[model samples]
Target chain A: MKSAVKIMFLSALFAMCCFSGNARAYEYQGVDIRGFISQGYLQSTDNNFFAETEDGTSQFNEAGINFSAEVSDRLRLGVQFLSRDLGTIGNNEVILDWAIADYHFRDWLGLTVGNMKFVHGLYNETRDLDMVRTFILMPQSVYIEAWREAISSIQGAGLYGDLGLSDMGSLSYDLQYGTVNLDSDKGAARLLGDQWPFEGMGLLVDVDQINVDYTYAGSIRWITNLEGLILGGSTWGYQFEADATTLLDTTNPMAAAMLQNNPGFVDLVGPLNAYGARFMLSPSEFGVETVSYTASMEFMWRNLVFAAEYMRTTYNIEFRNSPLFTTLEPVLSANGVAVQDGTIEVDQFSSVGYYASLAYRFAPWFELGTYYSVYYPNEDDKDGKERVAKGLDDQDHRGWLKDIALTTRFDVNENWIVKLEAHKMDGSAILLGADNPAPEDPAEDRYEEDWYLFAAKMTFHF
Target chain B: MKLRSIPLIARIVLAGIVLSAFGGFIVPAGHAASEVMVVAHGSVPVESLSRDAVQEIFLGRKTRWSDGQKITLATLKEGEEHEAFLRMYVGKTPHQFKNYWKSQVFTGRGKAPEAFTSPDELAEFVTNTPGAIGYLPQRAYQNQLKSFMIE
Candidate 1:
């Protein structure tokens, strides 16, 4: 089914290109069509960046096409199809990017329904369009690649409008509520699987189903009286639930010997006796709720552009009906701690991130840009000392990541752009566990704290 | 060594400046003027419009003329006159203008304006299409289109 959809999407793209070669704006029966294609290369000095970047990877690419038509003076309909890949992240999956029906009644009232883009900080909606931005890669603090699909767009309705404020300038607002689709092989699933603590003990997890019950996102930007300056604030929340299949591999002689010698382990592994030697944890409930807020500011003058944004997200997570609880219940009880119905409730924690960027169009065809970004996985454990003491992570630097980046862009022509970027990174807080597997020795560290990453990309749009 | 070669570099710079000044006079002035004139189809109702109103129209915020005709936009692919018109009327550079429209079209906000390779083509399109609006060099004015005075 996936391959069939991919073939159809590619055929449509080829047909569109053949029909319109030189025209960036093409119209057929009053409907407009446009598309973009970009390819990128990435290399890192020490650690992998979402893929196998340490050995240099060229799997980063994006292609998209859209069709839109103005049905009437007050109504418009449009849809876009996108395919992108970054190693195991996107996997070049062809999917519906957005399909929306928009209606406008007045300057202060408009409505949109269907799969609509999510409003985040300043650049989320346009992040995939490399031709429109100066940097090859956006600042990772707020635009984390791991969370792109989860927050890219929502399926529901939104109300957006621009309000005139007289001399105070104009204000634009967007309020949306919807659900997001999460795939089993995507980054979210891998990230969730990494949260299981018993993965080192011949345990493996596969996320079977992930569904976001509902999501709410809102954003308001104030185009201040000062020209070329804008201030904005955005907030979003999500309630998600998922089920996973966990298996204990008893084929390993070490696991079998331990199971036989350790009677306490039998009590935990006995309930999950389904497949001869392999135990399974089916119908396990995984629940997560998150709320995030961002503050953003952008200023542009002549050939110079400046932007800064900050975001904080709080998460509450739960794991129920898992063997990890049964295995650890005895330990907790021996330590005079209470266990609640074979369930674990992770304490709510917040992650904070911020970045400041500046770009200058030195010449009509060339631009130079730079930014410094920082992120902390747990704001309360910024130093990572508490997390290390609590045995959450092996390295203290895993709690925070700081990056300094420099980039140069060349607008070869109206239809093509090329960019090169370099980054000096200070930590590895966001690397996924699947990409960086745990070492055999429990005391060994798996990731390096300091590293360097370089990227280059070329984009063509019409 | 650097000090000894300073006079040669200065002389080269002076010669380049002199050549550029001479080259400026060689180009035709009739096709590229100091100011840009906004023009529309001769049958349009208004003879003048505020700069803010023109900006709104070109940015896709204002969709129609007061007389209920759908407004069609025409633009030059790229030139000095095109840059000047965008900067003076829309407060955007040619690159910025292109990026703005691209964002609008891809995001389903609006349709892209028709682009022409020359002022003559742009004027011809504006002249034939009803409720059409575009800009060209002041010296490239023709009687086939009506010019608007920006307030």
Candidate 2:
């Protein structure tokens, strides 16, 4: 309740700030406000096979109201207030989308400060817009939930600019320092209370409080054009993060074992390093006699992008090591294993993925495009960490996961656009927990089959 | 051989008709595919621009002109011939172009060009404003509005 009041007060203050100020009439110094809202109906053949309900269909679906105001030529402020239902679950939240102040010193140098998105690829910064992106599902590797948590946006400052390689090419660079948020924190006290069903007897109210801490990241992008072909390459650098799940109390040994086996659980706290590249070949100027194609391919190398990212989370806890190993085997006793205090530390995790999309303009106002991508995780941990954390079996490669999606858009007119898309996702990581066991099955491989989706959107901007 | 001679007036008329036909065949005027002049302040140093480069600058890809001047692409009112000009030269309708800038504007990715209602106003704005670049009709070229060649 107190938090709600604080949020309201802050919102009011922001509104006043937006409305107040010295009115400037310079050519490049004015405020530009824009927004869009979308509402539609959705029906699902099987709300995904993992869904507990039979046939799933929804009506009166709607998108949150999103708007951005260019406070000045150099600064932008925006937010997304939304209430939407994903399958059966619904959420109402206000996300601070972006607040940035940009300064262009020269054509070759610029700097920005505030909460900003990662410069992972061509679409990473602008992927939120349905109008700009070709696919509804972003390449899953870099944008997967786990990766989103690991490397998406941080509250910090960044430096970005271009270096002229020649008239035809330039190298783009970005460096950022920011803070990451902690999701939740659970302790052994909760587990013991759940197991014994006892209360008032040393019941530790270990509230899972969200934590905000320091984070720094950087990126380098090199783009050049050759014979009408634009080629871009980028590399991402980041600090790691770990999940919030940990056993703080020392009483329960079972909790410690569970934590040891699940050290790789996505820790909301950790350091990360990721990178990727994009190559776009546009044939509009190639003098192609027939249909022209604008083909773009992007590749991302990053850590795991799923709930299992917990195991790879960078925390000070040694959840990966415990007395269970020596207990299981006498020969393992020679390993000199140490009992972990229930924390996980991750040095780094990386994956390689790419999206290949081909768009052909059938007319001046219309175009058709198709794209697909495969994301694979690096299975470096032989301790079955990837399998248990990702819910895959030992047969799973630390780097073996793939997802593909196909999309088509029709520009009905200047003010309206309609898009139809279907996604064929394969892998244990894509599962959003529907038939999967509860969080209790930390090591369970909840691999889902080729789930399909049919969705559409309409947008109007003024 | 048949008549031994022809009337002088008739012969003269025949000769005039033949000469006129020859002249018509020999002299052909070039089609009026006139070049557009991008007018700017004398401070801007540029003589010519490629069609693609012009399109990119006007379309907001290339932010600066060759002379290191920040290129500010402006436009007249909707449905004006300027829309057709942009379409012909930049391969984008004026509405499409504005919306592109609008997206960039609200996103804080780029700056939106100032708009006017008439070529005269645009010319006046461009000529007076530093680092401003605008297009004017060749016929409207005067001492007040200078024109740069855009091939």
Candidate 3:
């Protein structure tokens, strides 16, 4: 199946190149064929930025092709196949970007079935299309790379339409409800691992599977009477349960010393904390529900576009630390640790992010854009004191990340684009643990607080 | 030979073929079409269109006429007349109009309108197709297609 798709993708690319300037006539069975290919390079002065950026890497690239046809006056069908690689993620895997059959009953009502793109903010649907935007990377505060695949498209169905408001301009809305296919070896699973509180309690987890019970996305935009002004609101939610393999690593000296010296220390599996002693934990259940929303505004006049958005995501999670470790009841009674039962004492936290951006196309060939974005993992714990007290991290900067980015885009022509971008980062909030693994020494710096990431990319579309 | 020297129908046909080949780019040094006209098929229900209606039709917002006939849209591939028509009637730059269609096509919303590189081809397309609408550079040729006076 993979090789078949690769062959089709390569065949389309070859055909498009041969008929580069005049691909408009390259239609099959009245189906229009269009796609883009992009290659990029990344180099970061301090931390790895999605890829192995510290040492520089060229593993950033994307290619996609779509076939669409208006099968009837009121119905259309389309599908796109995308393959992208970002660091160790994606690895150039062929995936269905979106496949939909749309039936337009009227201007104000339409039904889309099959797989459709999920709309979160103004730019989420277009994030993968490089020629459509001026930035190499979207503001990560709202469009995180790891979360892109998990919510980029839904496999069920959707409803979308545009309503005319006479002098009040118009309104466009989309609603989707469906399930998402999650990969266990992908970043989304690792992200869940990062959230498990027991990771700090000498427990390490490797995600085995993430079962998404349901996912939904909805968006509405008011195209105001004011020319080029649009105000919008969007939201998406998910209910998920994950399975994982856990390692009870208690060999670290601090964890071991705490286990041996604390009041409950000598009683509860103290031998598991022995040097080089690794124990495989028994089966535990992990469940999480997330609700995220964004309010957005964009104004476009002539060649200038200005946009601002604010997003907040709240999480409700529950987990059992160990089913076989004799429960938290015994430990709490011995050390007064306040574990109500056998569960990790966390149920909720919210993250907040927002950014304002502006881009100007000075000429047909040149564009410049910039934005400043700020994100906090825990809205209640703006400072890292709570994290350190909870043993989640050793440094305070892990609680927040702030970034200012600049991008220069050059449209060599209608078919080709080149871009250069630079980001000045102030914190290390969302850096993946896989990219920056923790060391046994608590005093060691896992990530630098201040860093810079540079990126250059070129794309060709037909 | 001067374009005026040809028969009316023949000129429209020749103009269409030449326009398809060169997008009306190589008109005689001293000759140029003046004023753009919004034209439609003779069977279309509306005799004229408001600017808003025109924009809606070109943007795929209004899919059918009030009388319930499906609307077929025709567009010039690219030319000065195309840019002028989009600016005057569609409230969009030629570049913006192209992007709008491209976005729609890629997103599975709809395919782009049938595009021709010649006015004659577009006129011919509009003439035969019911509920068809298009724009052309107004000239002195006696073409037999319904013309819409925009409000």
Candidate 4:
């Protein structure tokens, strides 16, 4: 709580210092410079939301600076450096957010080579700019925080253009093909391990490295003639391989048969009834292929803006070179004990998410916004019965998450902004296990079905 | 205890809001809506342009003109006339206009148009650069620049 107060005081002090500033025109000659920084606080009533929100963490912040220049009439060069921290994710790591050399041969055809931002939904490209967005946290349903780095940008070549449709309207399209860097210790890898129920059987997997073969993203937006309406669709695909290590306990099903038939396994039996012995498994690899698509619409009239989007992502996974076959099978077979020799199987499934949001600038200093968001980890198993049958979760609420959020944004000045938001959430689909560990009791639930989260943020930009 | 300090912060912020309201502190922009005229460089443009065509140019949709000349856009830094141009011609508020260009820049898609501090500087820029377009107060006078009527 004291940390939260300290952050609030810092933000207020920063806002006061920049209150009298004018609109920034950071250009000299032909180069333009722009940058922004923001700090935020979060507190949740029940489950932790990414950070240690239950204790009210002040560990959310982002900073970025960009430089751009028009080399000639047909060419432009631009780059931005960004650093962000959210709980254990970014850890204040400075990364080359985006750098591109863009050449427009014509309005209908342009080429960009370098690291370019990916367009998923309508707002993914602008998600990092706190001063531009209305919410302190965008809807988690469609924009899962865990996958931000995976889809934030692509490194390779992109083709973009705006085609005039005359009376019909105009169409803007972008196509990019490249690969993204993923950190095994980050949220994406942890989220992947949650897909299978290995931990319940005393088997745990730790990912050490992740590599992407290729990623392709494409988007098209139709700016209709109807004054203030836009329709857009975007899709991206990724193929990843992860090297992992596993730990298996004495009572592991694959080892159960070996222990029962052999009397020489009495050394393992004593501990099997006690704290249990753990064996390390040889390294294995996970092959994952994912495809995600989003359909979006946005409308603006006067000071009011409304947007809605539906997103679905499907993953096909195969784990090969399992410890069950490589490590324990040899030991058991040499002792005339037979063990299961196969890989763990996880069926292909798609996750579904959708949200509708509205924001209105009520006054020069005040804006109000609200959104309703929903997410299902498995589109076909919304009730979670299949998960319970498979020992994945103890409660049905784990299958889906529904959230309603309200935000009030205060524009303290032209260069500074402060915002507060509240969320009412039901269910727990994406809460990670690292922050919320399960109880020792097998029947006990790990997460609460209802919770509340509060957020406050302050941003300064020039 | 967890909830006690939050209201304190809220109260402090509320007091700040009330103080700002009565302190005579001026907001950066409450730009008055007005009739803003579109001016283009004399070297390359027609006398009149459709409203749709004007919106396309400012939004960076149409980068080239009918005569195949590259379109260079100029904008005022911030003022009543600047807000007027965005609202009347670009079909967006000043806030929306700023966010739009910022999105393009940060995403490495495109660069924002050149912005000038005063109408005379903007007029000078438009006059000197070929295929340039800008906006000014309806009565603002300029040299060697063609005025386009928004049909």
Q: Per-prediction TM-score of chain B?
A: 0.76, 0.68, 0.75, 0.80
Clashes, model 1: 0
Distance from true position, residue A26, model 3, in Å? 2.8
- Minimum summed lDDT over a 10-residue window in model 1 chain A is located at A330-339
What CA RMSD would you report for each candidate?
7.3, 19.8, 10.9, 6.1
Question: Which window of ten consecutive residues has the lowest lDDT sum in model 2 chain A?
Answer: A283-292
Q: How far out, in Å, is residue A256 in model 3?
A: 2.9
Please, what are the lDDT tens digits per residue for candidate 3 over residues A244-336? 766667765545655565564344443342335755666566788999999999987766789999999999977655543344445434533
Please state what fraction of the native interface contacts candidate 3 reproduces: 0.16
lDDT of 1 at A221: 91
lDDT digits (tens) for residues A1-462 of candidate 4: 645644554454345346525646366577776777889998887787888888888899987777788898888898887778888888766778899899999998999999999879899998999888789988988899888888888899999999989888899999999999999867888787776465655556778899999999999999999888999999999999998866556555645555465455433222222224766655567889999999999999878899999999998987665435444455535634344444544678999999999997766677778899999999999988888777677778889999998887888987889988888899998888766877767576678888877888999887
Better of 1 and 2 by lDDT: 1
DockQ versus reference, model 4 = 0.34
Chain A TM per candidate, in order of listing: 0.92, 0.60, 0.92, 0.87
What TM-score, computed on C-alpha atoms, does each candidate reach? Answer: 0.86, 0.61, 0.87, 0.87
Query: For model 3, what TM-score does chain A reach?
Result: 0.92
Clash pairs detected, candidate 3: B16-B120
Q: How far is candidate 2 from the true structure (C-alpha RMSD, Å)?
A: 19.8
Worst ten-residue run, lDDT, model 3 chain A? A266-275
lDDT string, candidate 1, B66-131, tens digits: 786778899998888888888777777677788778877776666788999999999989989998
